[model samples]
Target: MTTGTIREIDSASVDADGMLSRTMRILGCFTADEPELSASRLGALTGLSSSTLHRILAQMLDLGLLSRTPGRRYAVGVRLWELGELSPLALRLRETALPYMTRLYEATGENVHLAVLDAPAPERATALYVGRLTGRGSIPTLSRMGGRQPLHTTGVGKALLAMQSGDWIDRFLAQPLERETMYSITEPDAIRMEIDRARARGYATTREEMTLGNVSVAAPVGSIAGLPPAALGVVTRIDGADTRRLGALVTQTAADLGRALRAL
Candidate 1:
């Protein structure tokens, strides 16, 4: 393993023999960009020795926590997905929000997105996409159901960020903002301005910040007692798109969904 990987391993493996920690560390090696990895690659990335790595991999594979691909690479298994679907975020939130999201898509025929904050702490949070709807004519997006994105770059992310307290925002912004595109707002003050505008207008917008040639408008669903903070968004080609109109529609849809959730 590389020296950097060794150092990371040392730092993370304080409970070196803890099965839960080791399993989680192994799972963390998978990502959207690299969904599948060979045993050797897993050993290198996780800094687990070959023997230990193989042992864990064998157990995970047997338990259906992982699946082997045709090329002898491992991917997250359907069993994990089965477990995720049972979470309240999936059962209660997404199930309640889908009808409103479907109506929004029918109204605009655009890409509709639903995302939730992954952690209560702003500094550690990311926007986790839970549901998505898109038509053939809709502009493509990098976001996928079950994927995670930075809280500063996407419309749904910004909408969720706008709901946070000033101190929470400050703590979140203290971290280095990722620049997904040249147009992405990385400066803290500028992002704060965006958040202010979003709070005042009841929605947020991103102009080719996450992806080129696309713009998004979104609004938060407000907080529900049993649910993580969530938001709704629509993405479309920037050309001839009216952000204000879309913003209004998104804000209303998010509100409707929030009320529905509360009544349940």
Candidate 2:
């Protein structure tokens, strides 16, 4: 027996053009709304033939990149989640911020969130939530762990935006902001004013901007080594909510978490 290079067997389904790109295309088809997809649906979404789709799905399943579900549908595998947990944002930042976020939740009985800036460019920045805690008594929120939200419409988002450089902020505000609700501040100058207030007050506030009946108070966590800018915030029902008090609490918690991360 002699060692030899291995290659794919002759198959019309095999695509040699862009292995990485095609894999990403398949994975990207699964979203927060639809986590599991069947081969037919994936073929339609990716424009790949059934044979090619089935071949790639089989390879991904064996590698633990995807797993099969009932009715032959496939989902993101647990191995991907295990790898995500190894990221510094997860192991260090999210784990470190969990205790402080829990304290905020207990003190206010509201939805507490920890998020980091996901800015490839000034205009493309978003708040990427890393951790969230909510109680049964807490009002429902559109945010979830690992979800992205607009920086101009959410408290934690504005807080993160306030930490950017003046030039960066200028570029960020140059684009027209999307209006999430009637109360969402879409005017660039108005959002700039809110960012100014957040900078001066050590926290930011959003009153029914992201959702109709909720108010959020958030504060930025000062710089941490090897980590993107982060913020923590609380969301509660707007009625009878004391944003002032919540602001004070959020400010303190964010500061404390920043100190803890630096010490580590």
Candidate 3:
């Protein structure tokens, strides 16, 4: 079907849910690209009447979901971020892994990351970054707390995907994967091979895949017999460092974090 047709169906479905869906749509319109929006812009984007938009915006403001800026534009409030932080899986994983992540950063003087699988979607699997620790003067990274990245392009994403069932991995690999850098592996077979390597070695490594100058090593954070809730990774610049050795270190950290998570 055409994109317009799909959007119409989505709109109809949202309309079926009445005010709750409308409120959600309004909130959804604010994204990383457009963090702040005026009421008229919100009305235009959501296709809601100006009166209805204002009414909903006012309610959202009162409920602490949206805040009005000094410029009279609206942005997502800290209250909403706090509510997102309350997700049991993300919360517990972040809490359990932060100390280990910090230790990894301190030991390596790099960027340490903790990420969990985002909720399943029909199109593709993605990882939601839940925690991060950057050592002083560490290489800059695009990942941040609460950011999402594709499962096929990141070391942590590959590590998490490596632990999934074979059929699930096959289905996930069938999706169109984005090539974030020249070195990114776009072929499903290549990605599957990488997953296999991660499973055999108990860790994953990506060499300039997600970012041009960044190399990452990651390990899954869970029991050997169960699906992992998250992955732990460290990123560094590609400068002839021993990535295999780094992988081993990250694997040990992941194992420690996995034990802690199991205890929780």
Candidate 4:
């Protein structure tokens, strides 16, 4: 057996082995900006010794969780990507929302997004972006596929939040909320009112809340039976766009996507 295989066997023999956690930490070291790294760099980032890091990396390589690049740096392997594609919440939502998102982008010439709520936490709530479609002249945003954003400041986030129970909303509001931009709502009562409005209107909107000069309108991608699995939104420049009309379009698109998901 190869050294990596031997190490894997040895690690598995030990009860309550920390190898899994260390391996996860190594994988977590990579990001959108830093997709690849040398073993030494990974060791620095993860605080793992060279010998232990290399051994775990070798096992990961053997398992196809990571691959070595031409420069001997490592990156997440195609197997990881393949596994991510199998996720029901992220991949299924992306597949179901893509056609409608594209249609919304084409019709409005704006940036379209589909996001799902992260599991509820005591400290905060977040939205995980699953898919996006950028229009020809759409304003730039910090969001990326698989990236996360705070639930309070984003349109999709607010739409998803509006579907939560009142007690859950209160708990979320009790957490520390960052003011992302000048217009971001920081007061708990203000956000509570906003959530009430969104729940009442069947859609949500934010004007320069998450980012300056950007406005977004969104609706939940499911019914009020429970918290939505996803939300659909469009982002545009605040100055020239008719936000009310765009809001109507996004609400309709979200309803259509919701219906499609239900049929599945």
Q: Per model, how many backbone clashes are there?
A: 0, 0, 0, 0
The 10 consecutive residues of candidate 3 with the worst lDDT sum are: 1-10
Candidate number that wins on lDDT, 2 or 3: 2
Residue-level error in angstroms, candidate 2, position 15: 14
Off by over 4 Å in 4: 1-15, 120-122, 223-228
lDDT of 3 by residue, 205-232 (tens): 8988898888999999865233336889
Candidate number achieving the greatest TM-score relative to the actual structure: 2
Which residue pairs collide, candidate 1? none
Q: List ranges where model 2 is wrong by over 4 Å.
A: 1-17
Scored by Cα lDDT, where does model 2 land?
A: 0.87
lDDT of each: 0.88, 0.87, 0.80, 0.82
Clashing pairs in 2: none
Q: Which of candidates 1 and 3 reaches a greater TM-score?
A: 1
Candidate 3 has which clashing residue pairs, if any? none
- In terms of lDDT, which candidate is strongest? 1
List residue ranges in candidate 3 displaced over 4 A.
Answer: 1-17, 223-228
Candidate 1 lDDT by residue in tens digits, 19-128:
76677778878876788999989888878888888999999999888999989999998787788789888899999998999999999999999998875456778888
Can you give the lDDT of residue 164 in candidate 1? 90
